[model samples]
Target chain A: MIVATSGLTKRFGRVTAVRDVTLEVPRGVRFGLLGPNGSGKTTLVRMLLGLVHATSGSIEVLGEPMPRRARVVLPRVGALVEGPAAWGHLSGRANLRLLDAAGPGRSRHRRKRVDAVLEQVGLGGIDRRPVRAYSLGMRQRLGIAAALLREPELLLLDEPTNGLDPRGIQEMRALLTSLNEAGTTVVLSSHLLTEVEALCTHVGVMDAGRLALDSELAALRTPTGRVLVRTPEPDAVVGLLDGQVVDRRGDTVTVRGVEPATLNARLVAGGVRVTGLSEERRTLEQVVLELTGSGTDRVDRSPHGRRPEGPR
Target chain B: MIGVELRLMLRRRRVWLCWVLLCTLPTLVAILLATTRLAPPPGRGGAFLSAVTSNGQIFPAAALALVIPIFLPITVAIVAGDTVAGEASAGTLRYLLVRPVGRVRLLLAKLISVAAFVLLAVLFVTLVSYVVGVAAFGFGPDASLGGTGAIPSLSGVELTPVDVVARTATTVGYLALCMLALGAVGLFFSTLTDSPLAATLGVLAFVVASAALQPLDAASAIEPYLPTSHWLAWIDLFRDPILWTNVRGGALVQLGYVVVAFGAAWANFSTKDVTT
Candidate 1:
């Protein structure tokens, strides 16, 4: 494992920002930390980076005890905390140079390294404007560039795609994917399910400061032991299935207690036109919603505690 | 890390502006004094102001007196207070910490930067005032005949040019130590909060409280211990034989403040969970 925390917990006064979260990330996987807003994702990420000391438990990164050996381990790690931050008066390139100089990077290649990371993050032609003048997307890119300055073996990003446009997000995904392909371990925290779905090989869901779920994408998206059939003759298909249809919406029927192949053969044998038939599997959204609670952003006063549910 | 911090400090427009403003105050005073030819009556205005009209070489000491009470401390407090708190509010502290800039190392760098700003501001003020004083008043009568002028000490005796330079250099070092003590206080308050403004205000409040309590007969029991009480002791550097008593006491007091304040800062900062 590249990053491991056993029973890690953090408290801020009366609030327990992170509960006993024992998480592990292997050496070459894209791990997406999923959570609602204010569900301790940022706190946990800070703890991992040793910016926020844990109240209890232990953390190990790069096979060394965290914070104690942080000096040794963190040099090989890159991170973008809650958001991008730079000396507003300095240009993005200057900010990168200073941050690099503050650490243990070789000074001989500092200029070339900064330029390369800027190019990698699609800011190759950036001018000498101070970071304060950059748009939000530009700042986000600069933050990513700072994280990549040392060509770290592990990349820990929190909301890295925030303030980014669709194209920027796509580019970031490609960048992260390529970096991971080159033997880097990438762990990013975000609430965007589709982003996680498209990029991460493994996912962890956090709810109310607790690690509610930790599983591989494939494992969590396991078949629900049902088949989804789409046909123009929905009524005919339902009739032939003999009440095995658990749900019906227009031309589609969810059939249980049957395999896709058996269901398709039965449908054709019953003279029902089957336009589409496939096994039902849970999407990342469904899995997350099932594992986590309501969005912490919402405050409801209803006595019955009923919330307008689904994704926040 | 210290080098980077110093570079950042030197590059900041605010630091340079503070330096300019510090030097400008004394230059304006020199202009007003030179134009009017009416110095404040003896012992009535800033410490050496009454003596400045007769000797340009003495203006540096007078200039130091003019700014030491308010300008120097205020600017030092502002810069020092901004050290860690400014980075925290700007959201850069976390990044630096994660860069593996050791907590102790970063704090040391910040303290050194604050000290550097103090030295820079004090040196600029001294240099600018020296030039302004010479242009406005000319060298004293003794030096006008191409002879080395003698500057009167705080006592009645005369100080040769070499003595004047040596005393002024000593005054510079002493004042730097005093301001560094205040900077250490700023560093401590900076670690206590994330707002640089709050930290600066806290440092100012500390100074105000010290100054307020210094002259009160009821507070005399602790007067010798107050940080601001001995700040003027640098004036004793110009005494004929050099009054080392208060100067020595002031150095010790300021050194004590530096040790305690920096210790508190390091203790609080090293373990701080930098959520910002």
Candidate 2:
């Protein structure tokens, strides 16, 4: 595993920001941590990077104890916690240089590495404008460039696609995908479900400071023992399948406990014209919503509503 | 980490502005003294003001006197207080920490940077005031006194130019140490809060309280222990015999402050959760 945390918990005074989160990310996987705002995703990410010490439990990144061996391990781990931050008064390139110099690295390759990362992030032509003057999208790109400075073995990014337009997001996704393909373990935390669903090979959902669900994306998306059939003669198909049809909308009929091939062969034999046929599977959104509660940002006036479970 | 810290400090326009304003104050004072031909009477104005009109070379001493009380402390406090808190507020502290800059190393770098700033500020003030002083008031009646031209010590005895330069260098080093003690206090307060302004104010309040209690008979029991009580002790360096009594005592006190304040800062910062 590139990153492992067993029973990791963090508390800030009266509030428990992260609660007994035991997460494991195997090597060379694009892992997406999905959660709503205030669900402890950022706090968990901070702990993993050793920016926030855990009140209890332990963390190991790159197979060495975090923060204890942080000096040796962190140089190999790249991260963007909360968001991208740099000295506003300095140009982006100068900021990168200073950040690189602050860490453990050979100075001779500093310029070459910085230029390579800037080019990778599509900011190679960026001029000497202070970071404060860059557009939000430009700053976001610069933040990514800072993370990629040392060509880390593991990349932990929090909301990496924030402030990005559709094109920018697409480019970021492509960049992450290519990096993962090149044997870099990538872990990104974001509240955007679609973003996670599109990029991650493994997904972990956080809700109210608890890990609600953790599983491989392929396992969580197994076929639901149902097949969706579309036919102009819905009534005929329903008649042919009988009680097997559980739902119908327009020309589409949902058939349960039946293989798509069996149903298709039966339909054709029964002279029912089938236009589209496929097995049904649960979408990641459905699995996530079922495991996690509503987002924490919503507040209701009534006090009788069901409170989220855990130590208050 | 120290190199990066110094580069960051040097790149800041605010640091440069502080140094300029520090140098400017003494230059302005020189202009006023020259234009009016009125130097405050002996023992009445700044420590060496009266002597400055006679030997322009002594104006650096008067300039140091002019800024030691308030201007210098305020600038030092601002820079030191902003050391950690500024980065926290700007959201770069976490990045630096995750850059794996050890907490202790970063603190050490910041303290060194603050010391560098104080030294630079003092050096600029001394250099600028010397130039202004020589331009406004000539090299004094001693310039024609041949190769062994002598300047008067505070004790009214003649001293060679070498002695004057040595004493001035000692004074500069002493004053820098004093300001570093104050900067250490600012650094401690900086670790206590994420607000740079609050840390700066905390440092200023500390100095004010120390100054306020310095001369009070009621506080006399603790007077020797106060940070500001020994600030003026550097003046002893200008005496012909070079009184090392107060200067030694003051250096010890400042060293104590640096140790204790820096200890507190490291204790608080090492385990900080860095939520910001």
Residue-wise C-alpha lDDT for candidate 1, range A32-106, written one tens digit per residue: 999999888998999889898999999999999988999998999999999999999999999999999997657
Worst 10 residues of 1 chain A by lDDT: A303-312
**Best-performing candidate as measured by DockQ:** 1
Instruction: For model 1, state the Cα shift of residue A71 in Å.
Output: 0.7
Chain A TM-scores, per candidate, are 0.93, 0.92
Specify the highest-TM-score model's number: 1
- Show where candidate 2 strays beyond 4 Å: A231-259, A265-273, A302-312, B144-149
Query: RMSD in angstroms, candidate 1?
Result: 2.7
Candidate 2 Cα lDDT to native: 0.91
Docking class of 2: medium
TM-score of each: 0.96, 0.95
Model 1: per-residue Cα lDDT over B179-226, one tens digit each: 999999999999999999999999999999999999899999999999
Clash statistics: count for each candidate:
0, 0
> Quality of candidate 1's docking, in CAPRI categories?
high
DockQ value of candidate 1: 0.84
